[model samples]
Target: MDTVELARLQFALTAGAHFLFVALTLGLATLVAVIQTRATFGGNPVHQGMTRFWGQLYIINYAMGIVTGLVMEFQLGLSWSGLTEFAGNAFGSALALETMVAFFVEATFLGLWIFGWNKLNRWAHLALIWVVTLTAYASAFWIMVSNGFLQNPVGYRLDGGVLHLADFGAMVANPAALVAFAHILSGAMVVGGFFMAGVSAYHLSKRTSEQDFFRKSLRLGLGVAAPALMVTATFGGMGFGTMQVTKLAAWSGDLAAAQAEMVARHGPGDWLPPVGWVQAGGTWMMGLFALMLFVAAPSTLLMLFRPVVRGLRVWHWLLVAMIPVPFATMLAGWIFREMGRQPWAVYGLLTTSEAMSPVSAGQMRFSVIAFTSVFAVLVLINYWLLARAAKAGPAAVALGDRPIDAPQPVLTF
Candidate 1:
């Protein structure tokens, strides 16, 4: 492969790996906040246990996400210096905000939430998690702002070959960004819901002692996932109208027109994206969304019957198998979004080949190998830690002071 292809491959691997971590972190953080809120107000021991157990998983994923995000930052500078040189004035603003929100504000609140356990007032502790949750979504919002600019190139003007931010409001209010943000958030909730439900099903199928704990968790997971999936689908459909005409035409299999239009605008060249690959990504994403909704809605209804909930051994295994569905769906959607616009790094403004740094193919090759290896290790370690903690059950979680055998009744508001 040439330098451009190698650079694209490297970014795809790192970005894709980081996204998996971010999806779970975003979803699980919200779920943990909800569970913690219930624990605080309803004074339920099971809810408290649920919060700690799921929150640990959220922390594990969040920590690894930070590492991958840093790697992504380095990659942007290392491989795509042209993008920075050309559009940094406009694009860099959003990335800077995301860094502040994720690294400073979100991290500070999460740190307090983790250590504030039992030390701070219950209400104060509850407030911390909500802050972390909001900031997490805020961070994601800014990122979409940056990505949306690439898709639509809004709120910017060309000056001396550099893109300048002409209207910050226009950029923030980009229809492309707003619709994509809603779609991403709802999709994240679907990921979180399936993860929670699947983990609970694993425990339930094992006939663990904390039957009440896992059962409640399973119900919450399916309930959140069912509605979130519908919202995700809705926002996803809305996103189509905001897409570039070339992308929409290409996806609809009218690639010749898209190619001819691009040639007319910018002169003859390889003007079309990889149409088959982009279409395949969309196809897989839609199919998985349907499958997950089908399973989740019925499973949620079935969970209401106590006898059925306890005795559905086969169904529990099925739920466990369904855990990976949303993750796959999210990745597929990401590929469709990112790759569908390709050949252009900044839509009609800059070609991807032009955005890459002036590096040797060998250098790009080495970077790809090195980054992929590191990401693989991080991903494996993350899953290993999560699996170990999850399999250990609520009794073994270290988030709070209350023990299963503690002399005091679990704290009540």
Candidate 2:
């Protein structure tokens, strides 16, 4: 692979892996928080015990996510120094803001949640968890906004071989920002919901003492999962919609500019539109994305919207299919969105090929091999842990406010 291709591949694999962990991390942490909150309100020992139990699992994912995410930060400087050097004055500011403001805030609140349980007041302890969850969400938002600019390259201009911010409003008002974050955040809820509900399902099937507690968790998880997952899918459609319009807008401008060059000689309507392939491809992909959404809705509505099939197996599997559908659809949409705006990393500024590194053939090949190997190891570990946890039996595990063991009996005189 060339250096650019190699770097892209590494980042793609690593980001996807990180996303799997991160999706669950964000979703499950919220799940744990809700569980604990109910216990505090419900005054049930089973609820409290269940909360502590599930909380342990959530904490593990959180730590793993943080550790794995560190590598990406290092790679930004090491592998993509070209990107840094070019956009550092501007891009670095946003990245640094995320690290200092969002990341640290999240870390600090997480510490409070983990360590302050015994020392802090009841409300304060609960507040810590809430703070941690919100900070994580906020962290995700700012980071994605920065990335949004890369995909669309809005509100900027070229200056002395570097792109400088032309208008802050364009960056801040990027339509892609909220839609992307919403789509992603909702996916996080799905990961969290399925995990929590899956555990609860096992408990219900086995008839554990904590059936009630696990049931409670199952209800809460599914409740959140249903809407969040649905919304995730919906907003994914919305993001696609936004991208479709953006594709048209981008193509129109490019076509106009290209036509200007040829219009004088050809006298308008130069046989084909300047961006024929791109506009057509974007429209076609958009239609395909709509079909995917249609396939997704039935499952979402049956499993999430209605209570009639609350514990039905067929419905559950249908919902399971919907879970990953968004990934493919959104990816398709993103392909069209990013590809449509090609030839420039920042519009009227740096070209994508220009922003690439100066690494040699050997360096690129070796880097790909090394990063791919690392990615494989990480994926294996993630699955192994997930499998082990799955086999442990959710029935036997502790959950909030639920009785896992059998009920005690008393003899009457």
Candidate 3:
């Protein structure tokens, strides 16, 4: 395989795997934080147990995810330095800010929260968890902002070889960044909900005995999942509606300019539509996006309203399978977001071809193979580890102070 293809394959495989772990961490971390806060505030053992259960999973997933993520970061410089340097002024700020500022707070507060449970007061203890949670979300925000820039570059001016910051305020205030952050945060919550539901199901299937405890677990899972799923569905729909309209406006102008150019070149002889077809096409795409949103949102809300299904039987697998469909639909929406900006990496700043590295197409092919194989193996291992972790129950995996459990996908974004 050519190096370009190899790089693409590697990125794809590793990105998929990393998403599994990272999404879990984001969800799990928030969950544990919630539990910790509730236990401190409400004096509830159930919440404390919830904290312990999810905390172990959080640590396991975050550790692995950070490692995988670091590798991805390194690969960016090694394999795609061209893209980086080309847009470094715009992209680098977000990257460096995320790592240097956001991450330090997360790491430090996470340590304090984990180790300070007994040593700290009720308010302090709860505060630590919140700090960790806020830092984690902040970390995610910065990362997403950088990615939003990729999907819709803002506040950038093209220099001879690289893009420069035209306005930092514009980057922070980017409409795309706000919606992307909401989408990502909601995905994390959905992951946590799935984790709770899946675990509840596993225990419920084993026996009729202790049905109450398992039922409580199921309720606990749904408690977060219900609200989150509904809101996420709604929130994503609104975001897409806005995005769709915005895209229509953008394309309408582009097509108008293109058509005008054609008319100028061909004069009145050219078959330019008497009416502006560009506006019509733009409206059609907008409607299509709205249709996708309608299908995706209501269905996801339906998942929220689903009656609790306990047990690890065939039905449980079906539920798990059903869970990702809305997310997959969201993926389709993202495909629109990315592809709709076709032919340009940063709008009019640079073409996609210009951003491509000096590598052959054949290399990108082999890289895909390697990335795929590696991901298959990692996912298999992840499932094996999760099964073992669940077998032992949350308490066993998070005994005393440290973590020794395999990560679970619970959510993939």
lDDT of 3 by residue, 109-141 (tens): 877766665566768867877777787788888
Q: Quick one: best lDDT, which candidate? A: 1
RMSDs, each prediction?
A: 3.4, 6.9, 7.9
Model 3 alpha-carbon drift over 4 Å, by segment:
1-3, 111-125, 208-213, 241-343, 359-375, 401-413
Instruction: Compare candidates 1 and 3 on lDDT and give the better one.
Output: 1
Cα error, residue 321 of model 3, in Å, equals 5.3
Candidate 1, residue 89: lDDT: 95
* Per-residue lDDT of model 2, residues 174-293, tens digit only: 777778888778867866776676666555554556656665666676677667756876886777555533255455554455545434644554322225545555555456445544
lDDT of 1 by residue, 1-413 (tens): 88898999899988898899899988999999999999999998889889889988888889988888888888878999999989999988999988886657898988888877777889999999999999999999999999999988899989999999999999999999999999999999999999999999999999999999998999999889999999999999999989987778768988787788889999989877788878999999999998998898899889999877777999899999998899999999999998888989999999999999999988888889988987898799889998888888887777775533456566566
lDDT of each: 0.90, 0.63, 0.61
Q: Give the TM-score comparing model 1 with the true structure, all chains together.
A: 0.95
Kindly give the stretch of ten consecutive residues in candidate 1 with the minimal lDDT sum: 402-411
TM-scores of the models, in the given order? 0.95, 0.75, 0.73
